[model samples]
Target: MLNTYAIMMVLTLIVITIVISLVTRKFNSSTANFYLAGRKVGMLTNSTAICGDYFSAASFLGVAAAVYASGVDGMWYAIGFGAAFVPVVLFLASPLRKFGEYTIPDFLFARFGRSHVARIIGVVMVQLICIFYLAPQMVGAGNTWNVLVGVGFLGMSPYQTGVVAVVIIMMFYVAVGGMKGTTLNQMIQFWVLFTAMFIVFALILINGIGSYASERVPLVNPATMTVEKLMAGEEGSRPYDQAQAVMSPEAFAEVEAAVQQGDPAASVNVVLPQTNKLHPERTMTFQEPGHRYDWLNQFSMVLALVLGTMGLPHIMNRYYTNPSGKSARLTTLWVLGFIGFFYIMSSVAGMGGRKYVSELSGSDPAIADLTVDGLLLKSDQIMPVLGKLLFGEFGLGYVAAGAFAAMFSTVGGLLIASAASWGHDIYENYVNPKAPEWKKVLVGKIAVVVMGLFSLLVGIGIPAIGLDKAYPSLIAMMVTWAFAISGGAFVPMLLCSIWWKRTTRNGAIAGMLVGGGGSILFIGLNILKETGVFPAGSFGAALGSLAFPSIFIIPLSFAVIVLVSLFGRQGQPPYVNSIWARIHGTDALSERVRLAMQEAESRGRA
Candidate 1:
C-alpha cells in the first residue's frame, strides 16, 4: 500500500529525532544548556535552526494550499511569512541577542526595572501565542495522516491518531533533548522540508504541468461556478454547470446527490466564483486582490505578520543562542535567504496543485470526494496529494515525511519556548528562586508534556467545532491569528522597552493589556461569527469583520504606552541608562577581546 512507504519515511524521521535527543541529553545538565544551548550557537547553524522553528505547517502546507485554493489572494500568506523576518533582522535580532537573556520574559523583566508584573504578563502572552501556533501544526499533522495513512490506531480516527502520535513524539524528544537536541534536530529537519519543497516544484516543471506565466489566469470563472450563490438557488444560477464542465458523470452525480440532500453541515467540492470584496462591482481575477480579503484586511494581514515576528517568543529566544549580536544579525540574514527561496518554491507548488490535481478527479472515488472540478476541498492536503499524483508512492512518502518534519521542527521550538517561559520565567523566578539546577530542568520537561497535551486537545477540538469547514485554509488562518495576537501584544511593548528609555512599568503593562487583550477579543468574536454562534446582521458579526486586528491594535498599543508613560506618576526606571547601554553596546568587541586573551593564554602554556 502507499501508506507503507509514507509510514516508513515518517517513522525514520521519528527514529532520527529520538536518537538526536538521547545523544544530546548530556548537554542539558544545566538550565542554560537546556534552555539556550549554553548560548554558543554559530551564525549559520542558528539561522537554519531558526528557519526550522519559523516555518511551521503554516508555511509548508498552508502557504501552498492558500495559493492553490484562493489564487493570488493565497500568495499573500507566503509574502507575509517571508517578509516578517525583515523587521526581526533590522530592529530586534542584534539588540535582543546583545541583551543576553534566556527568554523573552527575561528580557522584559530586566529591561523594565525587574518588574514582576512585566515578567508575568510576558509569560502569559508567550504561552497564549505558542498554544495558538501549536494548534495549527497539530492540525497539519492530523490532516496529513488522514490523507496519507488513511487508517487509525486503537479505535481512534486517522486524524486523532496522527494528533496523538505527533504530540507523544514531540513531548518525548523535547523533554529529553533540550535546546541542544532541539537545535540539531531542527537544523536537519529544515533542510529535509526545504529539499522536499524544491523537488516537488522541480517535478511540476519537469512534467510540463506547471508554468510561471500561467499563474495570472483565472482558476475558475464566476459565470458558471457553483458556490454559495448556486446553492442558495438565486435567479439565473446553474449549480451543476461548472461542475459538469470539469467532472466526469460519476463524479458530477455524487456532487449533485450531496447538494440535493440539503444537509447544512455537508459539503461538496465545487468551484466558487470569486468576488471583489474591495470594490463590489469590479470583476475578480487570479491576479487581483479580494478572493480572501478586502482592502482593509490586505494591509492588516501584512502588518500582523511583519510585526509579529519580533514578538514571537520562540523566535526571539533563538537569538540568545547566538554568540554575539553581530552573529545574531548574520543569522537572521541567512534565515531570510533560506525562507525566501522556500516560499518561492511553495508558491510554485500551489500553482502545480491548481494545474494537476483536477486531472485525478473521477479516477478514484475517494480522490474525487476530495476534489471539486480540480481544486481540493481541503486545500491543506495539497502537498501530500500532489505528491501521490506526481511520483506515485515514493513522492507521497517523501513529501509526507517532510510535512512531519515541518511540524516536528516548529513544535519542538514552541515546546522549548513554552518550557522556558514556565520553568525559567515563572517557576524559577517566583515558585522556587533557590531551586537546584536539576529541579529546574525537571520542571521544564514537565511543562513540555503539559503544553503538548493542551495542543492535542486544541487540535482535536478544531474539527469538532466545525472550524475546519469555516475557513478555506484553516492552518494559515489560525497562524495569522497567532501572529496578530503576538504583534498586538508584544511588538509595541518590546519596541518601547528597547528603544525608548522613558517607558514605565505601568505603560508597558497597559500596552500589553490593550494590544494583546484587544486582539483576543476581536479574534474570539470572529471565530464565533464564522462558526455561526453570532448570526448575520448581529452586532457581534459587525465587529468580527475585522479579521486581522493588528493594524488597529499595534498602533493603539504604542499610543497607550506613550500616553500612559507621559501621564502616569511613575517615571522611568532609575537604571534605564545602564539597560540602554547594554542593549545598544557592541558585543563584538568583548567577544574579540575574549578570543584574543584565550589565544595568548594558550601560547604561554605551550
Candidate 2:
C-alpha cells in the first residue's frame, strides 16, 4: 500500500513549488528579471538559495549512502562537498560578482576580448556540466519513488514514472516563474530539507538507537564472511559459502535455485571481505581507507570536488544575483556554515542507518529482501528505508518529501542556468541580437523545456546503460564525474582569465578544450571499464581505472593556457587593463543604488 501520509507531504511540496512559480511569473518581464532575479536579491536570501542549488541528491541521499556502504571512505564525500566552497570564497566570489556578467559564457567572452570562440566553448561546458549533474538527481528521484510509492503508472515503471513526473514539474515552474520564482522556492526548499535532516538526526539521538561512536561497529562481522574466489573449473561462481553464513535459510534457498539453474547474471546478498586498495598489505575494515579508492584516487577525488565548486555554472550563476561583490562574499560565508552543519548531520544519519536497518531486517522479510547480510542492496535507499524503520509512515513521508525537495531545488537552479546560457549567451548575442525583451524571455523558457526533456532521457538511459549496477553508490559516483568535468574545464580557465593579465583569447580557448575534453575522455573510459565493456586484465581496463581525472587534467589545462599565451601571436587584448580594473575595483554602482533607496524612503517619511 502507498504510504498516504508520505504521498500527501510530497504532493503538498509539489503544489507549493508550482504556486510560487505561477505567482512570480509577473516579475519576469525582462531578461534580467527572468534570468538573474533583477540582480537585487539580499545576502541571506541568496545564501540560502545557493545552498538549495548546491545540495542535490548527491548531498542529501548519496552522501549518507556512501557512508553506509563504504565507511571511512564515504566520509570523504561529505568533507569534499563542504570544503569545495573554501576556494570559491577565497578566489572566485568577489571578483566574479564585481565583474558582473549574467552567465559564465558572458564572463569568458568579455574577459577574453569578446572572442566568439571562447563564448561558444563556455556554453558547451555549461550544458555538459549541468546535464551531467542533473542526471544523478533524476536517478535519485526515480529510486526514491520506487521505494516510497512502490508502483508504476501510465505503463511506466515506478522509476520511469518518478523521472517523468519530476521533469514535467520542473519544466513548468522554471519556464513560468523564471529566476525570481526559482530563488523563492529554493530558499524555502533549503530549510525544509535541512530541517528534515536535523529531525532525523535528533530522533536517532533521542531514541538512543545509535550514536556517532556506533560507526565503529560493523553491521555484519567480517570474520563470519569469506573472501570471494574463482572456482578452478567453473565458468561462473557464487559466494554460496558467504551467503549461507549471513542470510536466512529462506533467502539462501533462492541463491541455491539460481546457482542450480546456471544463471550467470544472478546475484544474491552476501558478505565478502573488503580489500585494502590503498595499502595492499593491510587488512581492510569499516574504519580504514581502502573500501573504495586507492591512495592515488583518494587525493584525486578530493581535488575534483574542491576545484569543481569554482567551476559549476549553476552555482556560479547565482553570484550574479547578489547586489554587491561584498554581499556575494558574505553569501558564500553563510553557505559554508549551512552546508557544514547539514553534511555533519547527514554523516551521523548514515552511521545510524548502519545500526538500525541491520537489526530490523531480520524480523521484517520485506526489509530483508532489500538487504544482503543486513546491508542494503542499494545504498541510495538508506534514508527513506531507515526513516520508515524508525518512525513508521510519518517518517517515510517526511524523508520522501525532503528527497524530492533536494532534487527540486537543485534541478530548478540547473534549468535556469541552462536557459540563461542558451537564451542570453547564445540567442541574444548571436541568433537574434536585436530581439525584444519578450522574445528573449520566450526563448529562455523554450530552452528550459528542451533541457528538461534532455535530462529525462539521460535519467532513463543511466539504467539502460547498466550504470546503476556498476557503482556501489551510483548517485555519488555520477555526481563526481560531473565535478571532474567542471573542475578540469572551467576552473583552470576562470583562474587564469580573472587573475592573469597575459591570458590571451587563444590561450583560454586551448586550455578549455584540453581540460574539458581530456576529462570527458577519461570519464567515458571509466564507465566502459565499469560496465564490462572492457574486460578485466586488459590494458583498456587499466587505463580506465582512474575514475577522477581532475588531478591530471587540471594542471595540464593550466600549462596549455600559459604556454600558448607566452608564445602565441594573439597577445592579450588592448583593453586588458580596463577589464582588470572592472574585475578588481569596488562596486560603485551598488553604493549609489543603496543611497538612492535610502533617499526615497527619507522623502516618503517627510
Residue 591, candidate 2: C-alpha displacement in angstroms:
9.8
Residue 557 accuracy (lDDT) in model 1: 98
- 292, model 1: CA deviation in Å? 0.9
Candidate 1 clash total?
1
Write down the TM-score of every candidate: 0.92, 0.93
Worst 10 residues of 2 by lDDT: 222-231
* Each prediction's number of clashing residue pairs: 1, 1
- Residues 478-592, model 2: lDDT tens digits: 8998999999999999999888989999899999999999999999999999888999989999999998988899999999999999999494777677677777877985344
Q: What C-alpha lDDT does candidate 2 achieve relative to the native structure? A: 0.86
What tens digits encode model 1's per-residue C-alpha lDDT throughout 1-606?
A: 237788898899999999999999999999999999999888999999999998899999999998887777788888999999998888899988878778888877877767888899989999999999999999999999898877889999999989999999999999999999999999999988998888798998887754434555644521222334446654445565644564557657767787687675564565546667876786666666788788788999989988898999889999999888999999999999998999999988987787688766456555665666556778899998888888877888889999999999999999999999999999998999889999999999999999999999999899999888778889999999999999998999888888888889889999999999999999999899888899999998999988899889999999999999989947467767666777886895544443554466469668
lDDT of each: 0.86, 0.86
Which segments of model 2 are wrong by more than 4 Å?
208-238, 242-250, 261-267, 363-366, 569-571, 589-606
